[model samples]
Target: MEGHIVLKNVQKSFGPKQVLRGLSVSVKKGRSLVVIGGSGTGKSVMLKCILGIIRPDAGEIRVGGESCIGLKGKDRDAFLARFGMLFQGAALFDSLTVWENVAFGLIQGRGMARHAARDIAVEKLSQVGLSSDVAALYPAELSGGMQKRVGLARAIAADPEIIFFDEPTTGLDPIMADVINNLIVDCVKRLGATTISITHDMASARKIADDIAMIHKGQIIWQGEANKVNVSGNAYVDQFIHGRADGPIQMDVLKA
Candidate 1:
């Protein structure tokens, strides 16, 4: 219950460009919510706002009944400690070895000793199907799928109460994407963590999401049970899921 996230009437802007226009959504504790949208739909912005990486122009962000806006110093650090993020493209540090990257948060954030942190890191890597031998290698040495797995290992190394997955399946073959999806489901189920994942991959969404929300022009156009998405009935949802070019949702393609 403490991991529930609520964002009410959230709005964000950059100068004349308003991004999130009264966006509101919520996810219950221990549930997975996947947000799907085309680029520049404020999906990533919303995550940044929730993480305090970007403060909203106006609105409320409450996590587990506590206000999260304008968090400072130790409060911000503490808030972040509760959440893990698997960034788009894996976002691994090239300078650090796989095991070191996984243990970075444990060693730096929580001040755990390197030996103990590495033990947990290796275990987390194993959970993600990476062998201990692979842990000594660098991100550059690993395949795209392997890098994603290492990023996942880092995310869960701390056993966070909540996880934010930013395009978790990006840059992987369909088969490998499904593998990552299965691992995500397994990991989330094991931790019972509240999860918010933003992805354009419907396969990944349908696999890992309990519920799905669609954001367009900075607001949630639709939100519902994943199983019922095909029948959501909304025009935008219909256009999106069907990947139809002709629908209520229009794409601004350049004239050729």
Candidate 2:
């Protein structure tokens, strides 16, 4: 598929445990794919593999038809320049001011002048509904929602071709989470970037996803358009979306 990021038969392992097993999925160009799954289902591992943070032990990962595995030095840096990520905790730098944090990649990675980078950062912050004054504040000075907004702004600061959002709405109140979800949808629409987001929040998924895929035990069990997730009929999908305790999907937790 044109402009698609495709993963085929990818696998990864840690110690005696296997994390990803033959995981495969395609995220079409300029569309959002939200992955849903229980904890320990290898969703994060799969995302890392795609981002080149964690290399897969086997199989293929292609970004726009070019294989991305084992990339090095300038190649890896250039490849990474195509991506922006919003981490689960917002993951802002406590020491840097908001705008500096937003411009980190442009300044450090691309060697852009600080003045130029700061202007771009301020612009991106405005896109996320933050004012220029907020740019001067440090991450620790902001509330959770504000911090997430800064994270979102930073993610789009470089206008990346692909963006990854890891549990974007986690750690926020319901209203704040919804606000963040709306911003995410709006930002992605404006950027027209291909995105892959992983979250347990079904409401966020419904609001932001074009396609939804479910991961279980390091494998994709079901995949379809966002609207069709309700009717997926897969036991695990149904259980997860409804958040039911008694279902085919059992917890791996050891009972006390």
Candidate 3:
């Protein structure tokens, strides 16, 4: 109950290939935890299991101290309502305006009136440093940074107790990425929401994480405070944080 989210011996497999092998981690209430891993290491799958988009083969996922595994119908919806997500690549609807995208959960999920939802959407957008006029524009018209801001607005619009950020700073210039990182830290602090973010960006991880955990081959290999990452005493952590190719971790690339 004290932790916002907890995963215990969770496992998931796709046919013969296992993605999450008894993975376990916990996010303390109102704290920020960042999961760092390389590509195809089941980072996304772990998040999907927590979101109920993918069912785990075994083990338990608890949100606010209640079991969420195998929840169905209204039970699942209620469980989902307590969380917000900012997906990788700002997965906004191209057909909708900025405000409409931000207000989607309020109007569709919560069944709020359209006008009222739009007003709240604008307010959330403002909190993310967007002007009111930008709300009338479609996602396609905005730059990458602006689109990310819109996605952040939508993620926080519901004011949920927990937020999940998947690759929050991916595909942006260094400056823009840092800006988004700052916004994420500020917004989560203001809302007092427990956050779990997955990223390979060390800079972003340093900016937003209180604790950092590294996943490799479907299991957490190391976990410690963000400040202690430089001296983590784990070769895998050193290889990852320094982006070195000559370390203990071997990539699965075919020999030329």
Candidate 4:
């Protein structure tokens, strides 16, 4: 059985501005792949394309040996049911309590009983080291780190076959960031899910990725094992990982 997710010659554009240009990558079953790139480099666009939130102008995307581009109606719902996402800002509902937020997919999307969904929500919260008490509070009541953990719990509530993490460690203190990273590794290992994450945070990437691919100006310029990123010998990768300003990668900043 082939369970690998593959993308080939993918392209997307918004009118005149092309976002993805023949971007290709693959992740094996039960492996973690992280995409690193600067802002507006189409990392999110590539992810959205895979999620079917955005349709690609061209190319192929295969998940578990089936095409996943431009799915509709029941097909789209079924395809989306196989994946989970943790957004960059937690993206929780301010009105809903934590448990309600976590169980939203189950009760709403799957039509599961609220009681059953709540139980699963509590269980997932435990997986991320959050207590049942925390599940009673709204998103606004929690600290930034706690809110992120809630997002993670909600992500795994459905026990998805594939999970996508978008900038998981952004905006947290270093210690909290490490905490989230450890939780992500533990949870993913326990579930044995194939994962795709988009971020420029090398620390989080190093902690979570089996493979790392760098995107630049709508293309994957370099890719390799996470352990070998330091010695990739590509100047762009070198400049990025080291956080250097004086490198081949130029920012589109206006003169101040």
Candidate 5:
């Protein structure tokens, strides 16, 4: 119960490809931890396993001191209720209005009344710097930044104890990304939520994380405080943070 999340030697595999390999990490309460890695380093798969979307081959995942690896039915739902997730690409329901999208979790997951949920949705939207007028418009009508704001509002609508941000600053201009990062910090601080973010954007990571962990080849190669990242002395971390081409990390290039 002391730690918000605990992963002990977690492992996952799909067919012949092994993903997470003996991964162990702990997320403290009300802190932000960012996981940085290249595209196929199992960053998303690790998150999926923690979310119970994918079952791990071996290891223990504990949330609030309870093992969540094999939870089922209402137990699983209760565990999930503690989390808020902002998916990559701002996955919103195109069929619904912005307000409706924000209220979806409230209405569907918590069984809140539409009117009350809509009001809360609008408030959350405003918190993310989206005006109430945008609430009535569909996602298709909004800009990319607006859509991301709406997605953020929905993530915080339930006021969860933990938040998962999957590439929160992706696909936005630098200025807009900074704005979103600031909003994320504000919202998480206000709610006192522990957060785990997966991002390749170093700026976003530096702005949002208290601690940084770098993953390579399905394992965490380095972890330290955000301020200590520059001196981590790990080649992979250096290569990643500096955006260097020549480093220990080699990209898999296909031959023509």
Candidate 6:
């Protein structure tokens, strides 16, 4: 079977700093792939390249066999409609009500009627373990965990074919993070959606990923089943997973 989403020889540079250099990886249909890396390892940039948010300086990005680079107008809009995203920090709009935020894509992107979108929004909120009463509240009115749940509801509201989760458990407590991870696993299963998630949290990655890929210096250094992560043998992978300060991996810390 072919990869549902594939990146080949993908290269991207911002000014003098090269982020993704010949980075390549693939995810099969209905499978979840989690990308594990530390800060500035091009994890988020890879996702943006796929989403067309940041154009790669060079390389190819394809979804379900079609090249997604350079898509414009309706083509771009159509391409984006097939995917959902849950950004770091939830990234909710303070001004919009919870339901409005969840329904934004349906009503704005698809031009669905307000009533129809609201109904779907309510249902999606419930799927994320939220109640209908919370739908009317603003982001500030909810706890951090509730806001994350709201972000999750919005992500699956459109029933997207693919989902990109950017640090889904970043600020949550361990229990709530696990809860979000469970919801992510459940939601992906329910939608039968292929997913690519970027996270530093090993627990989250292990829970949501069928396959795990470790990226370093703008390339995929290792890829394998999630169960094998601890035994991957690669020194970088070892240092990362074990949170070791000494290894092949090095952090750039400037002296004051």
lDDT of the candidates, in the order given: 0.95, 0.94, 0.94, 0.93, 0.92, 0.96
Please state every model's RMSD to the true fold in angstroms.
Answer: 1.2, 1.1, 1.0, 1.3, 1.2, 1.0
* Residue pairs with clashing backbones, model 1: none
Tell me the spans in candidate 1 whose CA falls farther than 4 Å from its real position. Answer: 1-3
- State TM-scores per candidate: 0.98, 0.97, 0.98, 0.97, 0.97, 0.98
Q: Candidate 2 — which residues are off by over 4 angstroms?
A: 254-256
Clashing pairs in 4: none
Candidate 2 local lDDT, 1-256, one digit each (tens): 4548999999999989999999989999999999999999999899899888898999999998899999999999999999999999999999899999999999999999999999999999999889999999999899999999999999999999999999999999999999999999999999999999999999999999999999998999999999999999898999999999999998877889
On residues 1-256, what C-alpha lDDT tens digit does candidate 6 reach at each position?
Answer: 7799999999999999999999999999999999999999999999999999999999889999999999999999999999999999889989999999999999999999999999999999999999999989999999998998999999999999999999999999999999999999999999999999999999999999999999999999999999999999899999999899889887887859
- Candidate 2's clash total is 0
Q: lDDT (0-100) at residue 130 of candidate 4?
A: 89
Error of 6 at 211 (Å): 0.4
What global local distance difference test value does model 4 have? 0.93
Residue by residue across 107-226, what tens digits does model 3's lDDT show? 999899999999999999999999999999999999999999999999999998999999999999999999999999999999999999999999999999999999999998888889
Candidate 4, residue 245: lDDT: 89
Per-residue accuracy of model 5 over 20-43 as CA lDDT, tens digit each: 898888889988999999999999
Q: Name the weakest run of 10 consecutive residues (lDDT summed) in model 3.
A: 1-10
**Residue-wise lDDT of candidate 4 within 69-169, one digit each (tens)?**
97999999999999989999999999999999999999999999999999999999998988999988999999999999999998999999999999999
What is the lDDT, from 0 to 100, of the residue 28 in candidate 2? 90
**For model 1, how does the per-residue alpha-carbon lDDT over 10-60 read when each residue is reduced to its tens digit?**
999999999999999999999999999988889999999999999999999
Relative to the true structure, candidate 5 reaches a TM of 0.97
